[model samples]
Target: MAQTTAKYHCLVTGFGPFYRYTEEENPAWLAVKPLTNSIIEDEQNNVRPIHVSTLQLPVSYQAVMDVVPLLHSHPPVFHPSIAEQAARNGVARPQKGYDFILHVGVAGRGALRVERVAHKFGYNMKDIYGRQAPVVETAPLPVEPEEPGDVPEEVLHISAPQIEQNQLELAEGPEPTPEPIRPKRGFGPGYENFQEEVYSDVNVVSLIRNMKQQNFEDVYLSMDAGHYLPDFIYYCSLAEVIRSVKPYERRRGTQVLVVHVPPVGQPLTSEQVTTALKLIITWVCSELQSIDDTLAKERFQ
Candidate 1:
């Protein structure tokens, strides 16, 4: 008989949307009820596909920090719901820091398709107010295609000559155009006002900074914010967030990756489980590899 070793579980966190006041909405926190019992079924089996910890926090950073201490540090929060998830499960606080912290939430502004922006800005990590200094702002302009016959994009830039002329006209117009669209000043979708939303973080900025500082060759951030960021920009008065650290000099550098989330409405029926096992196994295995690399280095080595 083979001896079974306990697997290291993750702590996942989410928050309710308080700032978003509307009819018939429970905020992102409502998703936790379903997320808790419904295991993160990895149909692809990329490694360890299951999310061991799943919990939610309010949109408020302080409320989130009431549970997880690390998240309380500063503006861009780390996985704010991890502590709640760990407690939700019977597992005592681990003897060490979490093997991984997975935070899941609704990406509100994701409706618009901005693969190029997501890809261009890389992780798109921003500050608490959603504005970063040194970044020039201008009205949205037509994106130049990367290649001929290619699609256009909306990467941030402030070099528009027309925006200069156009904003002048608009500013001189009716009361609405006094302030041109700008960071924290609102220039993107749904932001017609002189102000915009707050900027939160999944820690891509610090994580990238750390990787760069360490000169880690193969570290890449996995992301899932999708196109929702823009929508959030409108109601939240938030700015697009991205890491500020430059990767340390190295032969090779860190590359952040965005993972695709499985579609909603997963059924826990036996039929699905049987077919989905392969994917589950693969995801678990990949996660296992990540773990083995750090905690189980000897085994992997």
Candidate 2:
């Protein structure tokens, strides 16, 4: 008898509009909306289709808390109030738990950043409602910041031209542009000062490599998922994954990743961003299939 392959499911999330960017649409949602219910075919002929389930999360910190727990649960439940149509359509819960949970948000400026690590701590910056996260908290695991030098030249160059163009526009403005904000070396006061980082469970390096191989542009690995809503969601989701498992037992949990996109009116269009997203999703499903096949062989051996 021929063997049947397992279907892979992904939960892609994007943030809704916030008060700060009232006039402009959040690019995350704009990019993600096109992908919901989309079926991506594997480059290899034999693999089954990869199903994408997308969600538009509210900008509230409270919503992050409420929604993430549901995702972490076994056979995740979708409350009717969240989005009745989406819930009924299987967007809320996958028949088999999600293989990947990708959170997308706007990074204000920069190229398409495939974030490497999400810190447990949040900064003094407020959310959409002017609410702030606690200054410090115990990280689920320790993490070190990646050196800027380690970033690939190809990735760095992705946003160079656009950034330069923006600088020129700001230079010609009525008021002088302020100096660009540089990354801080150490954690600010109140925390132990150690780098408390949790990396994305997804194979970001391989993911980016695949994108480059396929001729995709402007995609880079980012070390910082700044202390804002994106970082909060990434950290919280990762924490839930870890918490779901037994303390000291090794198990393959859901693969979690946060992708930061540039703000609207940037050089890249919605189509370009959406294409990049589809490519990443395809790559992730392919990687997960390979892993599953390897594990199956090991079990039978």
User: How well does each candidate superpose onto the true structure, as a TM-score?
Assistant: 0.36, 0.75
By lDDT, who's the top model here? 2
**Candidate 2 colliding pairs:** 143-197
Model 1 whole-model lDDT (C-alpha atoms): 0.35
Model 2 lDDT per residue over 130-227, tens place = 76664343335666787989888876777778889988998888896689853332233433532468777788998999888988878899888887
Of candidate 2, the 10-residue stretch with the lowest lDDT total is: 182-191
Model 1 lDDT per residue over 1-301, tens place = 2323344444444444434432124333333344443344343433433334445544442242244444222222335445445456433243433443333343322121111112112213332334232232455689765763353344244469867988899888877536663443213332243232223322444444443454432223433344233222212211221222235521111111122222122212222222222222233344454545565445456
**Angstrom error at residue 132, model 2:** 1.3
In model 1, the worst 10-residue window by lDDT is 111-120
RMSD per candidate (Å) reads: 14.2, 13.6
lDDT of 2: 0.75
lDDT on C-alpha atoms for all candidate structures: 0.35, 0.75
Candidate 2 local Cα displacement, residue 245, angstroms: 3.0
